[model samples]
Structures are given as structure tokens and as C-alpha cells.
Target: MCSFKKVSPITSTGSLLCTSWKQITSTEVPAVSVIANNSSCFQRLYAVLEALSGVEPGEDVLRLAHKVQALPNVSFKGIQCYNGWNQHIRKVTDRQAAIDLVVEKTRKALQILKDNAVECNYITGGGTGSYVFMDVDYSNNLDESGALVTDFSQSLYVLSTVQSVVPGNRAILNTGLKGISLDSGVPKIFGHRDLTFSNGGDEHGIVRPSGNLKVGDQVWLIPGHCDPTVNMHNWIVGVGDQVWLIPGHCDPTVNMHNWIVGVRGGIVECLWPITGRGPGV
Candidate 1:
């Protein structure tokens, strides 16, 4: 009843090819459409045809198009053009140029499909790193006003407990590399702008205290990258008198845990199990 694309390695042109095609047609799944946004993908389409039919798919685009159209339940979908650089590009002009290139490439692909009488209906591809918490990497993107985009408010935080108080205005937290991620940058202390958080060790985080922090005191930290940080924890405490940790990324974070605890007015409202927690689920 549903259609989706599955990318898998094509090992052989014999049984594996027939099996792959039969597996799709034997199920209730709808026909899949091909995507050829670049020259490599275009060449791969011909390679796929040659493997299935045992006939060499030459450089003739029209011949390849006819071979694809002759398939039982397969259709040729349009191109997918993506510009990764534009997702986090700081300058407006540079981002615009990247977008222009994506458009140009997409148009050229579409034109080829049209000239060859290939049915291409979908043109899909564009993504943003910016999400709910707006991690450090996404913060670098600038708006047309030449200032940082501040439309979305950050809602994710890592709640940590102070484990030790050392000299030189330094305090150690229970959170560290195992509990938080520093791929983008070090975490920031929430509600304490003057204080700084640094990687201490595998299970410890060093912070320059604001003279008020002490052992057993809890601190909220804004993660540099939300995806891996959330993956490190099993639970996300909702809003309450107790500290709450909101995940930066939703999809991968949800996949890392088995259950989602929903709370309302400090009471547990519902619990949903994540049946699909990993690949091959």
C-alpha cells in the first residue's frame, strides 16, 4: 500500500537481480521510481538495466529510457538536487549561489528526461541542519538581514550534577564525553552565560563556576550537537520542578530509546514504545 526507496548493493546480475525485482512485485508495495540527479546516477540506471536484461545498455539515452519504461512496475522519478553547503552557509550570497547551482543541475536533468520521453514527476532534495534546539552548527547560518537567524527557540538541555569543586574556580560535573557530544563544540551552561563548560574526561565535565556552584548542585547545559547528545541518554525528563532535558534532534533521538514518557502537570500521562529502534526493524 505504500511506496519507498531501498538502497542496497547489487552484487550479481543473475539471481540477485531477479530476486530484488520479484521481492518488490510480490508484496503489496507500490512501484518504485528511479532517481537520477547527477551523471553518476544516470550511468548507474543504465548499469541496472544491463544487469537485469543481460543486454548492454549503450550511451543511447532514449534506448535506456525505453528499457526502463518496459519494466513491469517501475517508473522513472525525477532528479534530486541537494546543496549541503547551503544548509549551513553563513553568507547569504554564497548560499544563494549554491541554491542556483542546484536549480541549474535539476533543470538539466529534467530536460534530459523530457527529451528522451521519460516520465519524471518528482523533483525532491533539500534539507536543513536547523531543528528544534538549533545546535551550534546551524547557528552560523545568516538571514537576509546579515544577522543570525533567531526564529526558533532552543528547548534542549543536558542536566548535569556537580561532582566536585576544585580550586581556580573550576567545578566538575557528572556529564562528560559519554553523556554529551562535543563534535560541533563544547556545551554551554544554561542560565549562566558567564560560566564555561569544557571536556574534562570520559565521565566528567569541567566548568568555570560563577562562585555559586557547589557539589550536588545541578546545572543545565546546552549541547553543542543535539543528535548524538540525545542518543547518549535513555530518557528525557519533561517539564517539572525537576530538571528536564529536551532532545535537539527528534528522529534519531527517538530511535535510540525504547519508550517515550509523556508527562502532563508533573504526572506521567502516557508511555509509547518505539518498536523501530534501529535498522532492520
Candidate 2:
């Protein structure tokens, strides 16, 4: 509850896109459109965090002075690193030493995230540089590694199966990503036994060398990438405690929808107003 130049924050898309404001009475501060709706808020946020890194608030005063008396035995979390206002990563001068520091810091940040597991989507704030240099800590969980996103391509498989699944043959599989899939995102095969779905040119899936297929068996084909795969489908479906319909691309797809949808217990529900049937918002 200390007074700085002024702002409180809020975000709906992500904490990344969030903004804060100080209390403003109508008589004291006029509501300004520019500050409320744009990127200026981001710059302001950087300034505040940067300043806080150097200045101890009231609660830290005793701890601060005690450390001052001890002369250099302490480090503060609120201290700034490098440039005050950037979301980019920097190369470390000494790799091993920097790695040591990062491991120490991330171990704690991870604890904070686990504690807030029920309250946040992500506890994110090291820039791109931080992501590469800073993420390393754990007790007993296998890391899934970073996620790789790609566009839809006519060639290649997100998941590939041996067209030759001969029983006595060696196990042939090329894995790009390994983990659980929410829906497992299997591409749809319109109507052929040999599912021939390409990047976007050929309609039916390319039938590889005969992998003996019995009637009604499923082959989960991964798209060359996600974006075009999303476009190829009538809709890209997400299922979870948190299911959602995200646009693959907003502008082109906005006019194409006749209705909007929501889900509850595996059922799709239309939630748009009746007037939504008419175009042009």
C-alpha cells in the first residue's frame, strides 16, 4: 500500500496483454481512450517493475537496512537485470555461472507457480532469452521439452505409420513430438480406405504401400502443421475442462461463420444472439 506514481493492473487475454491503473476519480482524472486501449500500458508496466527492483517498499525496509549493515551478503528479488524495459533474452557472458544462477532462481519461481496452480494459466515473465537460459529445475517429473508449432504442409506427417506394418518387421516410427494429445488431433479422412489428406492440394489422403487395413480401424494422421490443418477442418475442436473455439485466423474466418458455439459435457451449444445471424457488427 505504498504510493508510487500510480497504476493497478488487469488482463483477460493473458497476463501478457494485461494492463493496470491507479485509482482515478472522475473529478481528478479524465478517462482517456488511448491509455485504456493500447500498448502504452505495456511500457508503463515495464517502468513500474524496473523502479521497484531498486526501491524497497515499506515491508522490505528493515530487511533492506539490515542487509546494508552486513555489506553485500544479500541479494534482492526486486532488483532489475540489464535493460529496464524489454521482453527479450540476452546472451550470458559465462555459460556455467549463468546457468548456476538461473537454476537457483527458476527453482523458486516454479514453486510459486505450483502453489498458484489453481489460480493461473501460466506464471510467465522471463523474456525469450529467459526461456532459453532460465528454465531448469525439478524433483520428480519428466520435462516434455519445448513445444514446436508448424504450418500445414502438403508433405510430411505429424504422426507417421508404417504403410508396411508387417508383423515380423522392425519397428519403424519417426517421432517429432512425444506427449498426450487433448483430442490427439487426428486429421479426418473424408471417405477413402487409404486416407489421402495432403497439405491442401490433393483431396483424398495419399495411400502408401499397402498396410493391410481391416474395416473400421483408425489411423491417426497428424497434419503437416496445425494452422492449415485447422483451416482444412470445418472446425478445430478442443476438449477439456476448458474447451474452446479459437479462430485459426480471425479476419477471413469471421465472416464465414453462421453461428457461434459453446460446449458443456461434450455437447455443442449455440450461444450467439439471434441477431447474430445477420452480418456486420
Candidate 3:
């Protein structure tokens, strides 16, 4: 049974209304509880749950959900918790532990809902980065050439040319933190695996070359975090042929672009406009 209503407003203010609704829903129970003692604004049929630990969410969220569901005139729909902090662990075992923790917490909440006789039909695990598998096994699958085996994470590349080389095996590049995200970590130099990249500032990057690298030589950087990095740019230039860019974080990156362009043989093929652009306040 689908207990959650997929509501959509056909107006520009739809998103704003939805955001406001979430806030209102979260706080309405407390306000109603206070009012129920004196006035008939609402009936305090369910108990108001106290706050639990800051890191782990508990019955308090479900308490609010129960209250919302009890509203006479309002349509009742289940909640969707949008938390995915634990899903970003690099190690597979660590990632599994994180997911298990989330599931454990979810199980507690579901029990609370069951006790309250509240129907929760839908629940979401996470958005993008949480579910993305960084390491993929493509051992059996191979191209017809038989020499090429596909790896998942080898997609996006920040191609830049070497600007200058200084003493102590250091080389300066034309891109830095402003061009790509360093939140997850610094990007590694593609091809020159021995070379390490460090932040020089917003507009510059320092590359410590393990081998000889001359000026004007090509250098490709694999981004540490792909979301904010791609958001910092407007257009993606494709070089030789068709390329599929897989983002480290897909949700935020998708919001950064206004248009998606398709190019073939160095010629513009098609363009599609993106509806949403997330702005930082």
C-alpha cells in the first residue's frame, strides 16, 4: 500500500512551498501540543517524543509523523529521511558498516511507527554518492578488440597543460581548487601516476613530478570530488570521440548546469537545457 502521496504543484513557487511545508510539518506537533491544553486547534492524541542524541535520530521524528497523520483535514503521507553521511566511506567494508548502521536506525523508527499504528509505506536509503560503487568488477566483460577491459571510475578527467616547471621536481599547472573539488581529496595526475598534485591556491595547482615533464606537456587530473568541480564550470569540452562523464556526486552536479551539449566530430550535435540550478546563499 502506498501511504505517501506524490504531490506536485504546477507553479514556480512549488519548490519553495514544499520546503516551507517540511519545516511546518516538523514543528507543528509541538505548537499543536501547547494549543491542545487550552484551545481546540488540535487534539493531543499521541505522545510528544523527546529529543534523542544529536547524531542518531529516534522516535521524536515518528512522534511528529504520528501527529501529522492524525490531522483531521490534512492528507497523511509518510516521511522520507534524506541522510547519507555514512555512505561515503572509501572502503567496501566500511561502506557496508555505514549502511548497516542506517538500516539499524531505520528499523528502530519503523518499530516506533508500528507501535503508533502509523502506516509508513515508503522509505529512501540515499541519493547519489551513497549508492555509487566506486570499485566495479568488469573482469568477464571485454571489448571485441580483447585488449580493453572497462573500469567504472576512469571517466571524468581535468585535462590541463603544464605551464612551468621549477626546481625540486615541482611543476605548476593552469588549474586548482576553483576548477575541481578537493573535499574528498586532491586529484591525481593521470598517465603520470608517480606525480602528486597539491593545492597551490584557487587558480593554481602544484604538481610534484616523479619523472621528467617539460613545459607544454599534457597532464590530466582525476578529480577527488566531481560534484563541486564540475559545477565550477559551464561547459564540458569533448576531445576525440563520445565520452560519458560519471560524477562522484550526481545530485549537486546536475543542479550546476543550465544546458547539456552533445558534440560529434568536433561539431555541435544537440543541446538540452537543465531546469534547475542550485545557488549558494
Candidate 4:
């Protein structure tokens, strides 16, 4: 759900030197101590530092370790998004508001290092999502060409199957009679059902309808909405949290790259490629 909303078609080959900036600024959250693990953990610690800070990896692992060991001049900001909390605004309206909000937060983040009396490097986790929201993209004062800049945390999932036919006098889903409460409108997808039941009661959800469902055919149910029907529970009999990982995050987090699904020694599973994503059928 989150990933699809952010897919941009990168048509421009030239630099995305955005002239506009966000006017909004963020309230600072107290910083936490991000302890460095060890030299081996960051085998190329200097390399990662270079990537985040835009500084040369002038020293080898040993040299960098020694430098930090003797005189630690930098503090670590876990350049990952999940590592931070999402910024809250009524909602971003104008570009200047977005720019100011973003820049203020970035400067607040730099304050963490500034308070520590240490210089810093921002190891940002970049992806398609960052182009729109990251601090580097929103700050107005910074040169389009720069050495270092910062941004604050960013925020940013789904479920299930229900069939609904469309173009009715009032938009409604077939799940109406299938233990579904229309807290939101019926889904809009054409062929599949993205309905949510009180629970994942069974694999197939029988459509309860006002005699609107067609025979020998099906409607694809795309999730018209996401309600917190289930988040506190541990597992769903056999398949609990596994279902949540399928949809993905709302705004991509810099910290998270890939997910590690801890399936308890279970059944053989095949990951179906989402429609139109790849050549696989």
C-alpha cells in the first residue's frame, strides 16, 4: 500500500535540483544515545561514515577506531527513518511550508551533535521516497551544491479480501453482509476483493450481498481502507503477523531496507509477484 503510492517514473535525466523548499519547521525531540557497536560491525566503518557524512574515508578501520578512541569528535545519528519518529503537521499544503518545516527539523537534528560538541555526518537512507521529503530536498538556505545538510524523522501498510461490484446508485461492497462494517466506503478495484473481516476467519470470505454479486465470476477486492482490526494480537492461530508484512510501510523509512520475516519452521511458501511488477506470472 505504502510502496505503490511512492513509485515515481524518474523521467528526468537531469539533476532534481528542486528550487522550492518547505516552510514548515518541526519541534525537536530529545536525542538518544546511539552507541557504536564495534569496528567489525562496521567493517568498513569509515566507508559508511563517508557515505553519510560526505567525508573521505581517510582512515582504515584501525585508524578510524583509534581516532574515535582517542578523541571522539562525532556522534552517530542512526541515519534510518524507523529509528526516528514521524513529523506531524496539520498537513503539508504549500511548498514553503513543507520546506521550512523540513529545514527546521534538520537543524534541530544537527543540534544533537552540536550539543555534544562534536562534528557530525548524516548517513541518510535514500530511496524513491526521499526525493520528496528528505531535508536535503527541502532546505532553501543550503547550496544546491553542499558539503552537509540534515533532516528530521519521517513517517509512513494493509489487508484482505472482499468482493464489491461498482457503479451502483450508492457505492457499496458485497462484504456488506459478510460481517463487514462500512467504516469507510466500499472498495474501488474491478476484479479482486480487498475486504476486511472481523478476523481472518477463513481463507475464502463468502460475499454477503444485496443480490448484487455475479455468478461464476469474481471481483478483485483492493483495500478501500485500513482499520486497525488487528495489531495487538500475537498471531492469527497459525498466521499472525505474517499477514501484515505483505502490504508494507506508508512512508519509506531510511533505517529499514529489507524485512526479515521470522517464520517459525513452517510450511513451504511461494511469494507471488504483485501484478505488473515483474515478468513472472
Candidate 5:
């Protein structure tokens, strides 16, 4: 919050060449933007998080913080990475190639900050489909030789009772777009390794089974993405008193909930209210 007055002339290249400056104020004050319809409310806000989609060049990305810092009373807090999420489904035959691409892009972005003398101490990013590669908190999980240590994919279960079973290894279920998200991909059928799923409509899920499925039989589905599916519900109920759930993209899903309920041993345990549940005004 220190203020300084210019005491040097600008260089011919249009860059600041201040070798000496006078301190005008030593008092600290929170930064705020005066514009409307923007995230300028400093009372309830601490920082701003901008999305880095990896689409822009690294040098261009560095200009984001430079521009913000050049403003009158606004500060750039940090950035959120989304390269993993957007590049998860790229048509790369080699799995390592995909991982390498994400790693390279992120390294370039960090290098931009290093070259620009901007201190990026805070950062956040990831989604269910892409967190495993970016996350460092492995906790107790580990893979062979500890090469892979953590799993961050969403594990929500979608159980649908079969309503109709037809020939040609095809069946219809009770779950559809109204209860799940299909943007990332179709859901995988649990316990049926050879089954595939597709969106039937708003109220139905089309399933192709490698084996037989009868009417009234329960079929479990693993959503390709978990966030938007949960946002489509008012309450998430659990059977057998258990549910292992995670959101694919937490930001939008969190904005859709007014309450989050927790249960244990088939009994209601707690209810937490969501104070921020809408697109910002």
C-alpha cells in the first residue's frame, strides 16, 4: 500500500525508467475497481482469479498481470489453469504425449512470470477429469513404484433401474440429461465392462449391453463429468448410507446449490447453507 511519485523521465522505448522515486504515502489501503458490473466489491472480496485456458501465448498471458498492475486501484491476484481440462480429450495416441503437452504449457506460463519479475505466490486450478496430473497432494494413495500417487476423478454413482430391455444388446434406463452431464462424454456402466451409454433424452439414458439386462434391474452409471450433473439436482440422496462424490468442475456446481446436506448411518447429520449461489451481480 505504499504510494510513490514519479521522479524520472520515461525512456524512448515507452517503458518506465524510474531510477529514483519519492514515497508519497505510507498508509495501506485495499485495492478496488470503480467500474460497475465487475468484481470490484472489496468489502466481501479478497482477490480476483482469472482463467488461463492455455490458448494464448505465454508472453501475452504475462501482459494480463502487467495491465492490471498498471491500473489506478486494482491488483491482479492470480490465475487459474484450465489446460488440463480442455486438452483431456485431445486426439493424442500416446497418453504420455497428452501429459507432456499440459506440462509444457504450464511451464511456459510460469516462465513468463519469472521473466517479467511478477511474483505469483497464489494459484488455483483443476477439475475432476484433469486434477490427477496437476495435484500434488497424494496423501496415502500410490501407484506402482509411486510413479502415480493420487486420483482426483469424481466417483459419484448414478444408479438407474432399467425400464425396457430390447434385442441387439440394447436397453433403456431412467437416467438422462436431466439427472447427469454428457458434455465431457457419456457415462460408464458399472459392473458391466462391455456396456456403453448415450443420452436418450431428458428423462432416459440409452444403454448398449454386452450381456442381458432385465426389467427392474438396477444399473449403475459413472458420469463422465460430475459438476453439472449435481447442479441439476436439489438434493443428492444416498442409498445404503454411503456416497463417494466429487464434482468435475466445482465452481459452477457450487454456485447452483443453496444447501449441502450430510448424512451418516442413514440419519441426517448436518446441513450447510451456500451464501454465494448465483452468477455475480
Candidate 6:
């Protein structure tokens, strides 16, 4: 694996004057090199230049690309051309227009690189907001049929137990602000369409119109946002005879736990320690 420390120079107009890239790894990991099957010591860097080029002058983009290409131990893989606004576009025409703009900008950037003799081999961009079921934020995105897209299944749920009940009106759950995140929106009850979830406090969740639910009944909640919610939990219970819990977000969520418990047929299969946990990891 290779890491680059970013150092940016800003212009008077708040545009990027240039970006400096420095490779911190002196020796390459043999495992990574073998997996890649590449003998070159140079690491590939995919620069997110679309946003910069869109905001900065064209000359600045060219200059930045040239500087990255000039780095000795780095290979400028290519540029990532994307618009974040496209992810939430509900109309097909509007989404197409956004994609067209991204294509135009990407072509312009590629032309500039080719003219300057900068070698660019690949281009990558776009996001999975339209393809995956992650949160309430993605629930509004429309497909070609003008209906909501449901390309992926939602497999993540927060298993919480009811601690208190108020008859037909409401029920209090064990999960609250600390158990789940509310930045995107309130979590939805997995099977109970009539029930709504709200933050009760640090240690409780409010379920309105609780219906037939009573104390000790388990509630499966679909998190509004999965990233921070996964960061709040230590264990991800897997499915089998035992309850299964999968992380909504993998990278940062794994950093919060000490071990990954793998199970098979309701039995403990293996244990992997998370060596890269805590700050700066």
C-alpha cells in the first residue's frame, strides 16, 4: 500500500494554485506488489481533478497535473471526473445533463494532459448512491421509469430491544443517540411501517404508534446513516442460528472494533484482531 501526504497552495481567488504530492513509503510491501504483479516501485495515484478543474482556471489544472506527473515515485493513474449533485437527481434528463457536463470536463482535462505529454492510463469517478440501499438520503433518487430505484437490498439493521412501553401510543427502545446516528434522518422500523423512530436521549429510542409491541420485544431499525451508526457499535452480529449484524460501512467501522468474529453454523469459526484501530490509523 502507498500513502501520499497532500500539501495544497491556494490562489488569491480561493482556487488551488497547485497541489504537491509526496510518497511516504520507502519500501514496498511484497504482498501488495505480488498481488498487483507489478515490478515497478512507482505507486499509482488517482487524482480527483474534476472538482478542482471545475472551480479553478484551466491553466491551474494543467499545472497541477504536470507537477504530479513529474513526481519520481508516483504514476499519475488518471483523473476522477464526477459531480456529487448527480447522485440526488430525481429526473432522468437532469441526471443525464449532469453526466454530460462531467464528460465534457473530463475530456477537456484529458486533452490538457495529452498536450503536455502527461501519461494518464485510467479515469474513475461517480458514486454508489444510486445503486445501493444505504440510507434515507438515497431513497429519493429516481430511476428511468420515474419511480424510486431499488437495485440493491438493504441488509443492515440495528437490533434494539424495547425497554419501556406506553400502551398503543409509544414504546422506548434501548438504542438512542449513542446507539445510532441521526445526521441524515431518524431511523425507520424495519418491518413496522406504522411505527416511527425518534431520538429519546443518549440511551433510549422513541417509537411512535407502537402498536402491538410490548416490553422485551426486539425492534430492527434501518439506520438513517450507516457510517457513523456502524462506528458507534463494537460488535457486528452475523446471521445463523444466532442473530447476524453486518456493518453498513466497512472501513471506518472495522477500525472501531478489536476483533472480527467469524461464525459458521452458529459456531465460532475464526477471530481476526484489528491491528489498525484508534487515532491516525
Best by TM-score: 6
What are the TM-scores, per candidate, against the unseen true structure? 0.56, 0.20, 0.54, 0.27, 0.47, 0.56
202-277 in candidate 1: lDDT tens per residue?
Answer: 8877777455765444544333232322423322211221222332333444554567655444355687797887
Question: How does candidate 6 score on lDDT?
Answer: 0.51
Separately for all candidates shown, the number of backbone clashes (residues 3 or more apart, or on different chains) is: 0, 12, 0, 30, 0, 3
Which runs of model 1 end up more than 4 angstroms from their true locations? 1-72, 128-131, 209-281
Better of 5 and 6 by lDDT: 6
| True-structure RMSD, every candidate | 11.0, 17.5, 10.3, 19.5, 12.9, 12.1
lDDT of 4: 0.28
Of the two candidates 3 and 5, the one with more favorable lDDT, higher being better, is: 3
Residue-level lDDT of model 4, residues 1-281, one tens digit each, is 00011123334422211211111122111011111222222332322232121221222222322334342323333232221222222223343365455455555655554565544444343224343323312222232244223343221112333232232211222222232222222221222233222222322222222345543333222222232232233221121111221112232221222332222224323333233332221
- Candidate 2 lDDT, tens digit per residue, 164-275? 2223222122221121111222232322224332221222112221256553444333323223234232321111111112222222332344443443343544455334
lDDT of 6 by residue, 1-281 (tens): 12232323322321111111122132232222221232122233233222122224255556655544444443345566666678667777898898888888888878887888877777778877533226555565688889887676443345566666654456677766665666656766554455577779988777764565554445433332223223233221111111122223333444555776554443556877978776761
Distance from true location, Cα of 149 in model 3, Å: 14
Tell me the tens digit of each residue's lDDT in model 5 across 1-281.
11122323332421111211111122121121121112222223333323222226487567656755675334555555544443343333443466567667767887888888887765555445444222112122344454443345432344465567664445677666665555545655543444667779988777764456554444443332223234232221122211122323334434545665554443556867988766683
lDDT at residue 199 of model 4 (Cα atoms): 22
RMSD of 2: 17.5
After TM-score superposition, the amount by which residue 155's alpha carbon in candidate 4 deviates from its true location, in angstroms, is: 23
> Which residue pairs collide in model 1, if any?
none
- Runs of candidate 2 with Cα error greater than 4 angstroms are 1-196, 201-260, 264-267, 272-281
